[model samples]
Target: MTIILAHRGSAGTHPENTMESFVAAEQFGADGIELDVHLTLDGDIAVIHDTTVDRTTDGNGRVTDFTMEELKKFKANYHYKHFFKKTARIPSLKEVFEWMKGNNLICNIELKNNELPYEGLEEKVISLIKEYKYEKRIVISSFNHYSLVYIVNNWPEIETAPLYSDLLYKPWEYANSLNSKGIHPKLKSVSDTIIKTTMENGISVRPYTVNKERDIKRLLQINCSAIITDFPEKAVKLKRK
Candidate 1:
């Protein structure tokens, strides 16, 4: 079956990356939840997709500029009235892990690029994964090849996937060099030849942000391991049809 990965936790219907969204994804029968992580000023991991809180939340300034305690004051989305009729706050990574403890769902954790160099961020993430004993269920991904390579080299037991964009330099070679288990290309950047070559090289290809039924079917026809989508319900229906 084509795995339905809920991009930022059924983001189309719920607030992205909040506990509510994650739980909603579970209720909606999504196979996995994909969320982004950024380290706060106080050495805490915050579950957010961007470097700043201005766009997604009611707060301003960069995520790295605030302490976790301060970040708790900000809401995850200002437009979540349709789902819960109330505001939701950003969730911590540990809180998310606790929520996923017994659920039969995988967690796709994307480590967002760093704004300031932090020592041992990768180690910290790996430690948390070990602490949760989620080695089998968690997949770490990053657009930063350095971070991805660091995880690949130091934590070989953990699966890693590199997020590729149109600007990637020799994308295949980079993925191959890092020994990534999978390659997550932007939906538009993916092609039949790329998928075929990636598979031939023993690397799985899973495209991101694909919501349309025709695109989902096309990717499946190319043997994509998964399709990360905002509307997982629609993707699931498409898969069934």
Candidate 2:
């Protein structure tokens, strides 16, 4: 069976990366929740998808410019404020881990340092994972392959996967070179044949942002390792059927 990982926590219906969203995803029966993290000026790991708060929040500044305390002041619900009655706030990685203590859902934390190159991000994330004793329940992914490499070299117990959007030649081989346990690619960049070959080589393949009904059914039919989608409720129902 294919696992359904809520993309940014059922982002199609919730303020992305908020605790409200993550909780809703777990209730929706997702096997896991995928989120992004950036280091704040205060050295706290804040869970958000963009380097700038302008798109997701009412604030207009770089995420790194604000301390976690300042970042939480802005409602993280700008994207879905009209739909949700209560305002959502940006959750710290520690807060998320605390919430995870009560659930069995896996977490795929994508290090959002590809563009900004956040110093010590891997160390901070690994430290938190260790602190929470979630070493077996977390998968750290990143577009910055170097960050993944750093995790692979320093903390091999923590699983890692490389995230890429462009076409690559024999990605499983590339993952093997990085000592990554999986590959997270753009949906269009994969096929059943590619997924099978990659898994055969001992690398899991999980495509991102997959929401369409037909696409979800196809992946489930072929038993793709997992899919990161904005519609976990719909995908979980499809899988159940």
Candidate 3:
């Protein structure tokens, strides 16, 4: 089946990365949820996209600039204040894992360390997964292949994948070299040929930010393993058709 992973937890409809958005994604029937994580000043793994909380939250500072307590002070729904009624705060990775206590949803945790990496990030995330015993349900992804390599090298049991923004030469081969089971490529880079090649090589091809209904239909038609979309409800409904 083509798994539908809500990008940043139904980002287009709710405040991205907030617990509210995550709940919305689950209610929308997403097969999985994709989120980004950054190390905060106090060493907590915060769930926000930018290096800073400026765009998503009411605060104006880098995520790394604030402690977990400081980051929690800003409302995550600041951007959608008028359109949405309820409010949420940026959640820690540990909080997110705790939220998944009873849910069986696949969680794709993207480490936002391609640039301005936090030291010991891999170990930080690994310990959390170990604590939760979610080796089967969690997938660690990053644009920085080195991070993925580090994860595999240290915790051989954990699942890891590469998140690339560009089309590469033999993407499946590259993933195999890094001991990855899949590749998260930008949507524009996915095609029938690429999907076929990846499938034949025994690797999965899951593209990111695929929101449009037409694109969702196209990828489903080609039998891509999964799609990372901002609106999981729409895509999952389309896949049903």
Candidate 4:
């Protein structure tokens, strides 16, 4: 079966990367949740996309420019403020880990370091997963192959995948060379040949941001390993049919 992972925890319905979003994903019976992480100025991990909070939050500044304490003060639902009356703030990695520990769900942790490399970020994230004993339940992905390389070198047991939006020369070969368990490419970049080649090499081909019922059916027809989507409810229902 093609597993469905809630991209940023059902981002289409709830505020992306918020606790409510994650909870809603779990409630919708998604197999896992995909979230982004960035290192804060105080050396803590915050779960929000982008190098800055200007788009998603009421505050205006880079994510790394503030400490975790300072970031928690800014409401994360600024963009959804007109529609969503509830409140949500930027969550720490620890907070997310704590909530996930009680659930029987998996999490894909995307290291948001391609634009701004966060030194020791892999270690910090791995340390938290270790603390929660979530090694088997986690998948690490990044656009920065170098970051994934560093992660695989330091912690060989952790699972890491490469995230790319553009077409590659030979993605499966490159992922295999780096000992990546899986390759995450944009849904648009994947094709029958890419899926076959990846499966031939014993590497999983899980693509991202796949919305629309027709696309989901197409990927499922090709027997994809997983589909990462903004609406897990729709994907999950379609997968069942």
lDDT of 4 by residue, 1-241 (tens): 7889999998989899999889989998899999999999999999999899999999999999999999999999888888888998899989999998789888999999989979889889999999999999999999999989898998888999999998887888889888899999998887878887887778888898999899999988888889899999999889888
Which runs in model 2 stand beyond 4 Å of their true positions? none
Model 3, span 207-233: residue lDDT tens = 998988889998999889999999998
- Order of quality (TM-score): 2, 3, 4, 1
- lDDT by residue for model 2 over 39-82, one digit each (tens)? 99999999999999999998999999999999999989976777
TM-score of each: 0.93, 0.98, 0.98, 0.97
The predicted structure with the larger lDDT, 1 or 4, is 4
Off by over 4 Å in 1: 82-84, 114-116, 167-172
Which 10 residues in a row give candidate 2 its minimum summed lDDT?
A: 78-87
Candidate 4 stretches greater than 4 Å from native:
none
Model 1: pairs clashing at backbone N, Cα or C within 3 Å = none
Candidate 1 has its poorest 10 consecutive residues by lDDT at 165-174
**Candidate 3 — what's its lDDT?**
0.91
Structure candidate 3, residue pairs in collision: 52-63
- The lDDT leader among the candidates is 2
Task: Give the Cα-based TM-score of candidate 4 against the true structure.
Answer: 0.97
